[model samples]
Target chain A: MASPLTATPRVTSVTGASQTIPAAAGIGLRAEHYHALLQTRPAIGWLEVHSENYFGEGSLPLTWLERLREHYPLSLHGVGLSLGSVDPLDLEHLRQLKQLIERVQPALVSEHAAWCSVDGRHLHDLLPLPYTEEALNHLVNRIQQAQDFLGRPLLIENLSSYVQYTHSTMPEWEFMPELARRSGCRLLLDINNVYVSAVNHHFDARQYLAAIPAALVDEVHLAGHTRRVIDGVPFLIDTHDQRVSDEVWALYRFAMPRLASVPVLIEWDAALPALEVLLSEAEHAQSIMESDHAVTA
Target chain B: MLSLPELQRQFASAIVDAHAAAQHESLWHDTLLNPGRLTAYRNNFRINIEDALAAIYPVVRRLVGDEFFAAMTRIYAGHAPSRSGNIHHFGAHLPEFLRGFAPTRPLPYLPDVARLELAYHQAFHAGAGAPLSDVQQQRIAAGGYADLMFTMQPALRLLRSDYPALRIWLANRADSDEVPTIDLNAGGDRLLIYRHLDEVEITRLDEPHYRLLALLAAGHRVGTLLNAVSGPSAISRVIQFGLQRQLFSELMIIENTP
Candidate 1:
């Protein structure tokens, strides 16, 4: 692994004025909204897509994304990189991601801070990592390797989890900031994830937010989750299938001061609504950021 | 203290079988509630694969009811676990799995249907192809036929099955208004599936035509391709059809001495 002391080179060859995403709200681009987004070109700050969706050879998704790039600054949020996995890094996956990054020239790139595959088998769902020194060391090394491979700083997001490791020696909030500091990467603080995991594991969400160093957070994510009552105990499932819930929105409101003007994304993966709904949700987030920014100013 | 790889291995096993999770339950906080959380993860994994399968194989889902399809996918997931992080690449082995699966054995044609769906899925994502330019077409027209080779579009997929798979596929299309009653003993299928614009177009081909196209795709020269046809008129007709459809992307003339 490259030494964390060495400065990781930033992505060069970045061309044009829209190369950087504005400090405003964007929506996760789903296949359902591709055509509508192209024809209508909704008013959102930017658009974010799951990088794996376009991993294949040229298709409708790639064609539309190239056209969409002209209108909106894009962010590549990866779900399959499995940066926290103990398994050997899938070099082919990294190569394709790099190719895409070069092709699209997205303003920002990010992945989950959780592992989703093991031993050549991918579970296809984000799984929580034990918050131990060993796991932290492993993740820091992997992040450094990934950053070196991509030639850009990767923004790692906090995942929503249902279970916590009993053997954990540190809290996740502490582990994350430390990881960012050591790896020379940044954080994509997912506010909805914090809320969901808090409800599931009985942690204080406010405290979790307070612990993270503000400067490390480069982006924020807000998504809806499903709540199920199991044996009279409520468990929140981070299923991005609905609108941002009242509680998650409130958490976003609270974290606004810490996050300041970071690029916020509203994600609705499953049970996708109409394009207008996503646009309006993003508009709502933009309003919040505007109001907060105005107050700060 | 479980190592990171050891924990991940155990976690993966626990996802499929709760019994395996029991041994590693101590690794998680709230052992009593860990099993429930594992179940959620398992459901998400199953749902992700099933959804990917459903997207690629919609006609199969239509032929077999949703409940039956879901059950089959659950079992199939266990047999061929996904190796790629992208779910779109998950169901490549579904056609082979259908061939060996016991419950679906009664429907011998099911495997071909699955293959057709896979082909459609592939063609949908295949790279865009450009038709040959007029100058290139003129070069082919000026052909010294023996040394000329033809290349087909990357989006082309040829499939042959002893069952009427294409008919079944067309009849089962979601927007297909009239359910054509196809005879079980109707005939076998020699199919040419290719993407045109954004949609996949499927057409039937006669034995000789299919063989000729297959040979061309396999890098046979035009002289050899012509020998497969019975006569000059027939070869001319085939060549005309090929040119009209823009079937071949490039035509090259090789030197005889080489």
Candidate 2:
């Protein structure tokens, strides 16, 4: 028998042609809201989804994604590329990602500037990487390799680190821009992650934004974080569970000028509220970007 | 000047083994803060893995209750670490883990139920194959029934258990409020787990029908299937049901070789 993969005549392109994402706020698409979003066809600017969620084949997830692709432009935000790992890149993961990109033709594809696996065992959390010349060189090579395989430049988002590296030769803010410049990749500039990591480590969030070259930034992320008070010092964890906190929103406002008109996504992964809640957050972010544009215009 | 590999290996070790943190403290900025801060990572790892397991094995969780399931998942997560970055691929080992898990020894049926759930999960994600073309169907219809070979759909799965796992699964769903009174003496179950379009279904099958699909699942030719079956009606019924439910994705007429 012929292979199942070739059993059907495949549609090579997305139904509605892939379009460039507008410089407005979009909500992170989660499984819980799939039906509601598809049914209502809400007035969100665009949608972002974790690339790994649709890694599997032949399911409601893929089915809904196919239908939703027609209605909204998509951004494939990956959490598991593990760009900083020492192990040889996962070619299988890359192959699946390539397949997804072909099917969806997303406007932008992104992965974190962190590693999650080592020696073939996947830790599943975005683990922090020490900032060093060697680490930077390894990451730059990996990003280039991934870009070569995918035939598209990826937007590498900075990680929300819980702790800082002692042996690091430079700060994360400096490390990210250098990595992006060397790798020929763009920056995702997750503003919430900047706030979370800044509070976790004693650093100014503004300095982190200052180091990123504005032209290289293609996207911005806004999400909620949780405050864990350990030893009376509040450590912010990028939980993505609650509403976009007031402090993170403030940081986003600061980032708006630097990011210019980059696409922003409001990501809420856990305890997802009604679709209206996410839409409202996206609207709020869009208003901020518009106001910034108004000032610049 | 630790290499990138060394740092990742050490960091992964630290996440799994709390004792390994001190040895790797130099890798972090503050050795004093590393232990507590790193504990948060450990918690994240556990939550992510546990949540993946829970998503796949909701019925198993319901059957064993939440607290027991949580404790089981903690041990399972540490012992059987995920091998893939995709969370959906994380809990493939849960069925085997439950087979050896001592605390759940009293619930001997839990392992098979987990196996059933895994089958359902696999079916849910299994790739879709094109149904046999009209010309191919016509050829199969004209060809000798005993001479043809068939291929099951990629989304097809057959599972047999010594417990009423299907019933137990149905009773434990979120929509089910009344506690189902299950009789352990109800004997074994043969389940046909297959995906129709996007929805996955688990159906209990009779022994003969189950045997037929099981044989077809193993790539046995239709002639061999007829030989193993007791009656022609059984063969016809299996084929009809298989086609109706989309059990087989393709049919082939084997060629004679010199």
Candidate 3:
């Protein structure tokens, strides 16, 4: 039987063509930095926001988003889709997302490869998925349904996990690309997540990056992680509160050669710093991307 | 081997229920997983929801200090696990939760404060709509005012509380350095919370105006509201106030009865 992802042709919007984000570097547009971002209009490639933040009918966030959209391309990154849940999908959530897509017409729309809810209860944290065929099949179906509903393709990002399921048959690196292939979705590979999960689960970060086919990757996310000792065991937490660590920067450098021309985003959600700090981070990523482009060219 | 659903069910249980973690320890890939690692996921779950609640109800957190607020939210989460994926919608039941909570009994006004905060939060995110146009205003001026039905803006939230919740909220603002001592006996407040342009505005409404606006917000026709309230002039003044504040998004002229 043909997979729905492959069988169904990609749907384009009837209203108009959506803007495409440049294959450069961008930063997450947070509420704290709205005024600074609007006034400065920093030379970043694009801005990404949590889709749920603007899901309200009308608000300051939506108003600011519209203003920012005029200055830069936008990407709607969703955290609440719970794409891997066993329960039926939240059509209302999907409908709101579609409405946002129409209003903002963001260049790229993305959601996590993990689920945040099960049994109709939302944990609101991106929980890890077991790397098994059954889990893989479920995620693919949900992603296809979401893609069809939005009338656009989605970029599924890898999540940082603290626990590896005993029943998982494959590694996350393999699972991610397979998900993209089967679901007809693109990958928003988060380098920090790869590093965090690799350290937590005892896998080589390079191996995780090596397994991803470059063509499947549409964007990259680099964020900070904190090291904490829990019950005498140390783990890397994807906190996104501080600067991109040296180790993650090294991993991005390693991944950039293969991910040439892929847009990269510097995400800082908690304890957001001044807008200048995020803009500087994006500049650093842009330099790395440009250097890689020079080498490949 | 557990199926995907079974693993998720157990995993969610372990994260939410502290006792369930030990039972689900065997579900992890033992070679790499440890008790501490599983606890990390559990901690993340709690912290994420708590942070969301804290964001939505900062004044509540300020009123009861961080430690108390944290404890309160932990219990609240267990009582009402978030039903929506959007964390913003997670704390809607908090006002009701605060009312029943034992620790907050002494602070009798806490729940009302929470209600005001919730209204402000809702007003901040509610949909925008154009207020009644010049033509509609002209129609109202031409008389037959008692037959008009007004539709409240999506952004408008009318809150009436026995406690001075608005003053309590104002005194506890993060930007306000000096916390003023508020008199608990100062009397209740009837507030009009709505988004004006990009900012959320909260105005204290007088009793007569509050009663009339409250009626209109409840979808009561102007004729019924006039019968309920004293004098046509008071109703007219409140309607004019509502129009000035952009409280009514639309207006409909119903049949005039003798």
lDDT of 1 at A235: 92
Q: Which candidate is the best by DockQ?
A: 2
- For every model shown, what is its TM-score relative to the native structure? 0.92, 0.94, 0.94
In candidate 2, list every pair of residues with a backbone clash: A166-B28, A166-B29
For candidate 3, lDDT tens digit of each residue in A57-161? 667688778878878888999999999999899999999999889887898999999888889999898988888999999999999999999888999999998
Candidate 2 stretches greater than 4 Å from native: A1-7, A293-297, B22-35
All-Cα superposition RMSD per candidate: 6.3, 2.6, 6.4
- In model 1, where do residues sit more than 4 Å from their true spots? A1-17, A293-297, B22-33, B231-251
- Per-residue CA lDDT of candidate 2, range B1-258, in tens? 556787788778888777788666665544323545888888898788778989999999987888888788778877887777787888999999888889889889998889988998888777555576666666655636675668887878899999888888888878888687999779979999887776887788999889988987888777776667876678778877877787777776665511
- For model 2, residues A1-297, the per-residue Cα lDDT tens digits are 322222446556455834789888899999899899989998788999999988776555877888898999999999888888887899999999999888888999999888999998998889888888988998999999999999999999998988766678899989999998899999999889999989888889887887788898999999999988988888898899999988777777776666658889999999999999999999899888877642221
Give lDDT tens digits, candidate 3, residues B205-247. 8898888888888878788877788879988888878778778
Recovered fraction of real interface contacts per model: 0.48, 0.54, 0.55
Could you say which candidate leads in lDDT? 3
- Candidate 1 has an fnat equal to 0.48
Between candidates 2 and 3, name the one with more favorable TM-score.
2
The residue-level lDDT of candidate 2 at A236 comes to: 90
